[model samples]
Target: MLTARFKLDPEDRVVSFHLEGHAGDAVKGENIICAAASAIAQTAIGSLQDIARIEPDYQAEDGLICCRVSYDGDDQDQLIQIASLMGSVRIGCMQLEDSYGSHYITCIDES
Candidate 1:
């Protein structure tokens, strides 16, 4: 199963997110669950770096993706944009989890 963990800051903003493991719902190349998760994650990362211009630390590999947004006190606009992008990712993952409960799990941690 795929495990997706979203870590939030005191203000309830997602500071980091980690997605690992495969859905195992189908063969490696034909898993729609995995494909949906991957697309959401990659799109969010691209938006954060390209549109938001926020240089979040990130790593992507087969069946694994980890990203942590660095907070800049002086850049509230950029931070908000990043938050929106991450929110979209979270929503997509949540929908996947709801539809494929047995193949995907989502956890949120607040700190």
Candidate 2:
């Protein structure tokens, strides 16, 4: 199984996901990114079933896609839930500072 590493910052709405072991290109990378993002968004949106809009713009570097997630919500718990759900998609290193309004989450694919 292929492994990937991702660093996420929910407050900044940015993530850097690194793919390894044969994962390649923007097309394939998009799937993984979207999957993780969708899981997070799904959790955050909850029963509301609101879809978070993902911007098309992304940066690809050495099989990594630096993507951004944009969503506006009032609850921090919801964001944490989203980050946690992403952990299911990939092993994540998450950092959050409510005082500073900063959330950083990193995920590495473990298959």
Candidate 3:
């Protein structure tokens, strides 16, 4: 099963996410769950760096991805954007977890 993990800051803000196993779940277009998970994760990472202008420590390889970003507490814009983006990550992950019922995917690390 695919595993989704979110690392959170002390205030419960998402600092990073780690996903594994989905990309290899099936042949192309065979697993909708894998595609949806990939989309949600990639969008979150791209939007954080490209749209929010927050550079994160990240790594990507076949069937694996991890990204972490530190937010500036003094920057209101960063806080707002990060909050929303991270919330999206949380929601997307939880929705998948709920809908798939841990057979296709599982959420971890208090996410």
Candidate 4:
């Protein structure tokens, strides 16, 4: 099974996320669920660093990715950009969960 954990701030913004594990529903290279989940998570983080120009604290390894984005209340534009990106990640993961069902994948949000 695959699991994603999202940590949210008081404003319900995604402050951080940890995604790991394989869906194990198929052979490793052929797991569509895993591929979709990984694409969503990686794209969001990549956008943060490359497009948004923010270097979030993060680490990555085989089947594992964990990241945290920092923001300032004074910079609404930056906050909005980051929030939007994070929201996309959350939305993507939830969509996968909805499609694949909890038996293969799980997404949890933490306050």
Model 4 ranges off by over 4 Å: none
Question: Which candidate, 1 or 4, would have the higher lDDT against the true structure?
Answer: 4
lDDT for residue 42 in candidate 3, whole number 0-100: 81
True-structure RMSD for candidate 1: 1.4
Q: Report the alpha-carbon TM-score of model 1 versus the true structure.
A: 0.91
Between prediction 1 and prediction 3, the one with superior lDDT is 1
Give the clash count for model 1. Answer: 0
Poorly placed runs, candidate 1 (over 4 Å): none
Candidate 2, superposed: residue stretches over 4 Å from native: 1-3, 10-72, 92-111
Write one digit per residue (lDDT tens) for candidate 3, span 1-111: 778888887888888888888634578557787778778878888898888888777787767777777777698887889878876876887898898778878888753
List pairs with backbone clashes in candidate 1: none
Model 3 segments more than 4 A misplaced: 23-25
Per-residue error for 67 in candidate 3, Å, reads 0.9
Candidate 3, pairs of clashing residues: none
Q: Model 4: which ten-residue window has the lowest total lDDT? A: 70-79
Report the lDDT tens digits of candidate 1 across residue range 67-110: 99866667878878988988787788888988879445564554
Which candidate comes out best when scored by lDDT? 4
